[model samples]
Target chain A: MFNPTWAMTIEMVIAGVSVIGLFAALGLVLVLMERRVAAWMQIRLGPNRVGPKGMLQSLADTVKLLVKEGMTPDGSDKFLFNLAPYIAMMVAMLLMAPIAFAKDFRLWDMNIGVLYITAISSIMVISILMAGWASNNKYSLMGAMRSGAQIVSYELSAGLSILTIVVLTGSLNITDIINAQADGWWIFKGHIPVLISFVIFIIAVTAETNRAPFDLAEAESELTAGFHTEYSGMKFALFFLAEYINVFIVCAIGATLFLGGWMPFHIGNWEAFNHVMDYIPSSIWFFGKTFFLIFVIMWFRWTFPRLRIDQLLNLEWKYLLPISMFNLLLVTAIAILKWHF
Target chain B: MSGSTIIFYLLAAITLVSAVLAVTTRMIFRAAIYLLFSLIGIAGIYFWLNYEFIAAVQIVVYVGGIVVLIIFSIFLTQQAGEQLPKQKMGRQLFSALAAFCGLALVMLQLAQHEFTGTGNKAVEPTVANIGYQMLGVDDNGYALPFEVVSILLLAALIGCIVIALKSKPEKA
Candidate 1:
C-alpha cells in the first residue's frame, strides 16, 4: 500500500519540478531584463525587433542555441565536455531550494540553510574546472585555474562575513535569520560595521560568482570566452542560466541576511506603520529585496572593466580578507556589548 | 530493507568502487572524473544521514574545491592526457596487502561493538546544537576539540603557504 512517506516523496518531486520551472522562467525574465537595462543605460533602442520591447529576445536566442550545432573540439574529452554544462546548471538550480521567499516556504528548511548554500555554491568552481580540463585548450585551463583561485580566496571572506551574521543572529537557519530581521534589518541595526561587512559580502559574492570586474575567469580578450570556450547550444545556455541564477541566489542570501527578507522596514514606536507593513505579502517583499540586489549586481556587471588576475587576488588577500577579519572582531565586540541603534 | 536503505547501499557501493577506481586509474583525467563520482556518493551518504547541510558542503568543498583544484593542477602541469606512471609490482603488492589488513581490522572492530538495550532511532544533530557545542556551552560540547579543529585548519593554511612559496632550483 502507498504510504505517507510515498506522498511526501511525491511532494518532493513536485517541488523539484517547480524549482526547475522557476529557474527557466527566471532565466527568461533576467535575460530580457539584462538586455533592456543595458540598452537603457547605453541610450540605445536595444531589441525591439524580436517582440514587443524585445520581450522575446531571450526566447529567440534560446531557439537559436537549440538549432545551433553542438560542436565538440577535436581531441577533447567528449564525455566530460558534454557533461560539464549540466553539472554547472544543476548545482545552481539545486541551490535555489533552501532560500525562503515567503515565511515557512522553502524546499527543505534545514537548520543549516546558510551553510548548505555556501557549501553547494562552492561546487560551481568544480564545473568550471571540468569544462576547462576537458576542452584540451590552454586558455581554458588557465581560465579554470584563475576561477579556482578566485573562488577559494573570496570564499574565506564570504564565509567570515556570514559567520559574523551567524554570530549576531545566533542561528544559521535562514528562517530564523529572516525572523531576526523582523524589527529592522541587521545592516541598519549593526550600523557601520555591518555596512562594511555588507560591502565586503557584495564584493566577495560578485567575485565568487565570477561577475564583471572580478570576471577574469572568462576574460574575453585574454582567454577567449575562457572555460566554456568550447560549449555550445543549450549547453552554453546552461552555463549562462547558472551564472545569472547564482547572481540572484547570493543576492537573495544577502537580502535574507541583511535586508530583512520578508520583513518590511519600520522605525521605532511606529505602531501604525509597522502594522501596515505586515499587510504586504512576504514572498513579494522577499523578491522585491532580492531583485533590487540583483539589479545592483547587474549594474556593477555592466559598469566595471574586468580585473586583472593579480589585482583580483590582491583585492581578496590584501583588502577584503583583512577588512572582513577586522570587521568580524568589531561586530563581535558590538554584539557582546549590545551596542546598536 | 526499505527503499531508502536500498538506495543508500547502492550509492555506498558506487562510491567505494569509484573511489578505488579513482586511485587506481592509470589515466589521470579519468581518475579525476571517477573521484568526482566518489565525492558525489559521499554527498549522497550525507543526505542519507539527514545532514543535508553537510552533504551540500561535501559537494561544494570536496567535489567542488579539492577535486577542481587537483584537476586544475593537472592541467597546469601540462599532463592531462598522459597515463600516470604505473607503480612497481613490489610496492603495489605491499600496498594491496596493507589495505586488505586494514579493512579486516576495521571489520573486526565494528563486529566487537555491542548493541544497547533499546534500539532507539538516532536523532540527527541540529545546526544550532552543533554550533552551540562548538562554542563550548553544551554538555556534549568538546570545546577543546573545537579549538583543535581550528588549530588544524591553521596548520593546513601554513602548510599550503609553505608549499606554494617553495622555490624551484634554477635550471642548468
Candidate 2:
C-alpha cells in the first residue's frame, strides 16, 4: 500500500489531468453537437467532409487555431489582452469542482456548493469586460458593455430560481440537493412553483451565458464578433471553448437540481422499475440528463430569433425577475409547510 | 512552514501588493484590475480561514458586483488607455501622511490586542450557523441590524430610481 500523502498527491495529479482532458473533449463534442443541431434545424449537411460524418472537424479546427498566429493589436494592452483568455478558461474550470458527476463523485464537495457556483460564475463577466477593453476596438467595447449589462441583470433571476431549489432542499450543498430528489425530482414533485422556477432558470441562464435570443453581446450582424473581435488563433478558441464548457456546467447544475441528477425516474411502489433503473450506471444517468438539458438549450438557440438588447433587458427586469421573486416566496412557503413529497 | 501557512502568506502578499498597485497605478483601468485582484486575494484569505460562505459572498458582492460597476462607469467616463494626470506635490504629501497615520493606528491596535487563536475550538463557519446568527432574535443575534441594513438598501434603491427618472420634457 502506498503512503497516504503520496496516494493523495497522485490522485490530485490524475484529477488535474483528467479535468484538462475533459475540457478538450467537451469543447470538441459540444461544438460538433451544436453544429449538427443547427444544421438539422436549417436543413443542411453540417461538416461532412472533415472526417467520418465530421467526427474530426472540431479537431481539425483545433489544429488550425493552434498553428495560427495570435496577434496582439498595436494599441491594445498586451498584458491584459493575453491574460483575459486564461481568466475565462480558469473560471470555467473552477466551476467544474462542486458539480457531482456521479454518486459520491465530485472534486470538492463543499457545503456552499450552489453558492460557490453562483459566486464563481459571476466573475465570468469580468473576463469578458477585460477582453473587450484590452482589444482596444469599438465593437469589442460595445460587446463587453452589452454583456456586462446582460449578465448582471440576468444573474438576479437565475440566482432567485436557484434559491427556489435551495429553499426546497433547505441546503445549499449540491449533493444534498440531488439526494433530496431521490424520491422524485423537484420539477415533478414541487409542483407549479418548481416548474416555474425551472423555466425561469433556463431563460435566465441562457441570457447569463450569452446564448441565443440573449446574445446581444456578440450580435454578429451588429457588433462584428463582439468582445473577442480582436482575438484570433488559440486565444479566440479559448473563449469559444469556455462558452461551451460553461453551458455544460450550468446544464449539469440544472440537472442536479431539477432532474434527479444521477437518480433514475421511478414511480412510488414500483419496486421493479426502480430496481431496473439501479442497474444502469449512475454516471450514465447523470450524463444522460445533462446532455438532454444541453440539447434543449441548443434547441432554444436554433429555434428562437435573437432579441433586441432593450427587449432582452425588459424581459429580465420586467418579467422574469418579478416572476422568479414571487416563485421564491411560493417555494419557501411550500418548503415550510412540508408540501413536497 | 506547512502548506496552509504558506498559502496564507502567499494570499496576504497578493492582497497587499495588489492593493498598493490599485492605489498607485497611473492607468485608471489597470488600477481597477488591480483592485479586482486585491478583492479576490482578500476572498482567498477568507477561504484560508475556512469562512467559505463569507469568501463566496465577498467575491460575489465586491469582485463581481462592485468592481464590474466601477469598470463600467470608468469605460463610460474615462479614456481607459490614457494615464491619469500626476498628482500635485501637496496633495500627494497630504495623502501620504493620511495613509501613514491610518497604518500607524492599525499597527497600534494590533500591538495592543491579545489574539487568542481559537484553533480547534473555533465554531464551524457553515452557512446555517451564519444564517441563524444573522436572523436570530437572541442577544448574540444581529437581526435588528440586518433588518435596518435591508431598509437602508431599499431606501438607496428608491433614491437611485428617483434620481434616474427623467423629468417631463419641456413643451417646445
Candidate 3:
C-alpha cells in the first residue's frame, strides 16, 4: 500500500544524494576559502603544499578527522551526545529543499515557502542545546545558552524583514516571489525601502546562522570550541557541514527574495537586452548572487569581533526588532503609495 | 490502507511513544530530550497536513526556541548529571489512570461526532487561504487574533526575562 509518485521518488533520491555531495564539496571549498581569506587578511600564504595551493587539504583533514577517536566525557548524557550532531545536520539539509536554485528548480514549491524557510532554519538552536547538555561541560553549556539567546532574539527581526518581502511580492512561494521580481528586482523596484529591508535581512540572517562576530555560541577564546567542545571526528564534521550549508541557504533565500532569482538586470524598454539577460541560466545567476552574500558574511566573520551575549540580545530586541518593524511599516507605505521608480 | 494512511499511523505511533516518554521519563533532562523528539514528530504531522509553514514554526518555536530555553534552565539550575527522583508509585498510578480516562473520553466524543465542513466535505488547510484569512483580506479576517498573538509572545518574552533575572542574594 506504500506508493509515492515516481517523479517525486526520483527527485527526492537525486536531491538527497546531490545535497550530501554538496555538503562535502561546500565544506572542503569553504575551509580552503577561509584559510585563504585569513591568510590574505594577515599577509601569509595559506596551506600551499597539499596538492597545489592546498586544494586537497580539506580531503586530508577529513581523513584525519575520520581516523580520530570521538570522546564521551564521564557523566555525559550519552544518548543525546550522539544524537545532537545528526539533528543539526538533518535540519540544515532540510532547509535547502525549498530554495529556487534556478527558474524552476526546487524540491517543493509550497505556497508558504518564505515562512517555512524562516521556521525550519531556527531548529539549529535545539541541536546546539542538545550538544551542550550532553557534553557535560560548563563551557559547552554556556556557549549553547548564548546561542539559544542569539537565535531567539534575532528570529523576531528576521521574521519581520521576511514579512516585508511577503508584503511587497504579495506571495509566500519562493517561485512566486522570484516571479514578482521579473520586471525589476525588489532591491531596485522598492528602492530605498528595499535597501533598508535588505540590510536588515542580512544582519538578522547573520545572527540567525551564528556566523562569526555574532558567533558567541562557539567562540574559541571564551568557550573553547563552545557547544561542540567535546565532539570530534566525523561527528564534529557534521556540525561544520551544517554551518556552511546554513550559510548557503540563508544567502540563497536573501538573493531570491531581494535581488532577482533567475531574472537578470535590465532597464525598462530594453526587450532585446532583457532577453539576452535570460540566456545566462538561472542557477548560475542564483549561485552568483548567493555566493556574493556568503562572501559578505565570511568577511563579517573575519573582520568583526564577537559581541557579548547581553549586547547581542539588546541589539535584537531594542534595535534590530524595532527598526525592522518600522521598516516593514515604511515598505508597506511605499507599496501602497505605488512609489516604484 | 492507502500509503498516506499507513505512513500517518506509523508517525502517530512514534509521536505518542515519544510524548509518553517525555512525561514519564525519570531523568528530567532525558524527559526534555524526549519532549524534543515528540515535538518533531508533531511537526512531521504538520508536514503531512501540507501545512509546511506550521511544521516549520513547530520546529523553530517549540523545538528550537522553547526546548533550548528549557535545557538552558536545566543547566542554570546546576542539576546536571543527577537523575531526578522517580515519582511515588501511588502518584504514578493515579496519573496513568487519569490519562487513560482522558483518552477514553476524547475517543468517545470523537466517535459520536461526525462534523463536516461547509458542503458535506472537509476543507484542506491551504497556506494561501489561511494567510488571506489571517490578514482579514478575504472573508472574516483574523487580524485581531493575529495581533493578539504578538502580544502573547511579548508577554512570554517578559515572563522569561523576569524569571531568569530574579535572584537570591549570593551566600555570605
Candidate 4:
C-alpha cells in the first residue's frame, strides 16, 4: 500500500501547492477587482491609496484578517462550527482538479468532468448549513435554509443548461468539450435555442454561486453576514476566499463550455485574423475569456438589485427550469439533425 | 495491498463509519452531514470501479438532491441543538440484528462466488457510449429503463406539486 513512487509523490506535492496557490491568487485579485468595479459603477473612485491604484488592497485586507482574533461564540457547536469553513474550502479545492486550465494542462482529467464539478459544488450547501446551524443564531439558520433551497433548486436548471452543450458535443470530458468548440463556439452554432441556453447557463451559475441578484443567502440588510454570522478572523476569511474562488471556477467553466476554452477566436475564411489570434498564448486566451465572464458577473452584482427569496425560487422553478428543459430538447433535435454550424 | 485495493478499503471505512454515525448521532444536523459523507464515499467507490457516469449520478442525485432535502426537513422539524430521545433497547437490538444479518449474507455470497470478469478489461467510461447505450436499438440498449426513469421522475414532480399546493380557505 505504501509503494508510492518518487515521481508520483513529487507530482502530488506540486499539484497540492499549485491548487492552494491558485486559490490564494484568485481570492486576492477577484475581491480587489470587485470592489473597484463596484466603485466605478457607483461613480466613485475606488481604493487608490493602497499599492498602485489599490492593487494590493486585498493583500492588506488579508493581513488584517490574519491578525484578527478567531472567535467561536458561546453556546455554538464547537466541532461543526469550526469545521464548516474548511469543508467549503476543501470542496472548492477538490473541484479544481477536473477543470482544464489550458490545452493538456489539468490536475486530473476525469471522464465525467462536468458532472464531477456539479456534484462536488453541491457539498457547499451542506457546509453552509453546518455553519448556519452550528452558530446557534436564528438569522444564520434562516440564511442557511434559504441558501440550501436556492442552490438545490437552481442546480436543476444549471445541469440542464450544461446538458444543452453536452448534447451538442456528445461528451462530458472537459477537454473534449473544449475541442468540440474549436470549429465554432456553442454560443453561436446551436442558433436560437443555444443562445437561450447560454443565457440560462449564465444566470443559473450566478445563482448557484450565491451572487447577486440571487444572493438571498447573504442579504446584508436582513441577515448580518448570513451563514457565517458567528465566524471571525481566519474562519471568516476562508469563507470569503471560497466565495471568490467559486466565482473564478464557475466563470472558468462558463468560458470553457460556452466560449472556447483556450482556443483563439477565429472566423470562417479569415486567415489573417485567425493567425493573429493564434499569436497570443493559449493560457492567456483561457484567462482572458474567464476574466471577461467574471466581469460580466460582477456587472450583474452592481447593476441588478438583490432578488427576494420567493422571486429567486420563482425565477429558477418557473422560468429557468422549463426554458432550459425546452432548450435541451431543441439541442437534442439539432444534434440529431446535424443542423448546428 | 495493491494501490487500488488500499483505496477501496479507505472508501469502505469512510462509508461504513459515517453511515454508522449517521444513524447513531444525537444531533439531527450532524447525522445529516454524516449521511452526506457516507453517500459521497459510496460515490468514490463507484469511481474506483470505473463507473464514472454512475458515480457522478450518485453524487448529483443523492448528495446534491436528496441529502439537501433531508437537511432542509431537519431544519424545519427540529431545532439545531435539540436531540431525539434514545431508541428503546429492544428496537435498537432488533435494528442491529437486521443490519448484521444483511451484511453477513452479502459477505457470504461474495465469498462463495467466483466472479468471472469479461477478460478483466477496464471499460472506458465515456459519455458517448453511455448515451448510445441509453438510446440504442440493440439488445443491450436500456431504452426501456431510461424511459421508465423519466416517467418516474415526472410522477415524483407531480406528487410534490400536489402535496405542496394547499387550497386556500373559503372566504368568511
| Separate DockQ for every predicted complex | 0.52, 0.57, 0.52, 0.60
Residue range B1-172, candidate 4, lDDT tens digits? 4556777999999999999999999888889889999999999999889887898899888988888889888889987777889999999999999999999999999999998868676646687777888887799699988999999999999999999999899899
lDDT (Cα, tens digit) per residue for candidate 1, span A1-341 = 57765766788789989988889888888888888878877888778988886789989998898898888889788877888898888888778878988888888788888888888877778788889888888888888888989998899999899888888987788888888877788999998989999989999999999888898888898889998888887788888999988888899999998898878875556798889988988899999999999888888888888888889999999999999999999999988888965
Between candidates 1 and 3, name the one with more favorable TM-score. 1
Please give the distance, in angstroms, between residue A307's alpha carbon in candidate 2 and its true position after superposition.
0.7
How many pairs of residues collide in model 1? 0
- Of candidate 2 chain A, the 10-residue stretch with the lowest lDDT total is A1-10
Which is superior by DockQ, 2 or 3?
2
* TM-score of chain A as modeled in candidate 1: 0.97
Candidate 4, DockQ score (0 to 1): 0.60
TM-score for chain A of every candidate model? 0.97, 0.97, 0.95, 0.97
**How does model 2 fare in lDDT?**
0.92
lDDT of 1 at B14: 88
How accurate locally is residue A85 in candidate 4, as Cα lDDT from 0 to 100?
95
* Candidate 2 positional error at A93, Å: 0.8
Model 4 residue B44 lDDT score: 92
State the local distance difference test value for candidate 3.
0.84
TM-score: which candidate is best? 2
lDDT of 3 by residue, A1-341 (tens): 23565555566689899988888888888788877887877788888889987889988998998898887778898899999999899988888878888877777888778878877777778888889888988998888888888888888888898888888878888888888887878888887878887888999999988888898989898889999999988789889878888888888889988888766775566899888988888888998998899888888887887888888888888998888888899989887887765
Model 4: residue A1 alpha-carbon error in angstroms: 15
TM-score of model 2 (CA atoms): 0.97
Candidate 4 on A267-299: residue-level lDDT in tens? 655788888888998899999999999999999
Model 3, A195: alpha-carbon shift in Å? 1.0
Q: Which candidate number would show the highest lDDT if scored against the true structure?
A: 2
Q: lDDT tens string, model 2, B15-114?
A: 9999999989898888999999999999999988878899999999998899999999999997646788999999999999999999999999999999
lDDT-sorted candidate list, best first: 2, 4, 1, 3
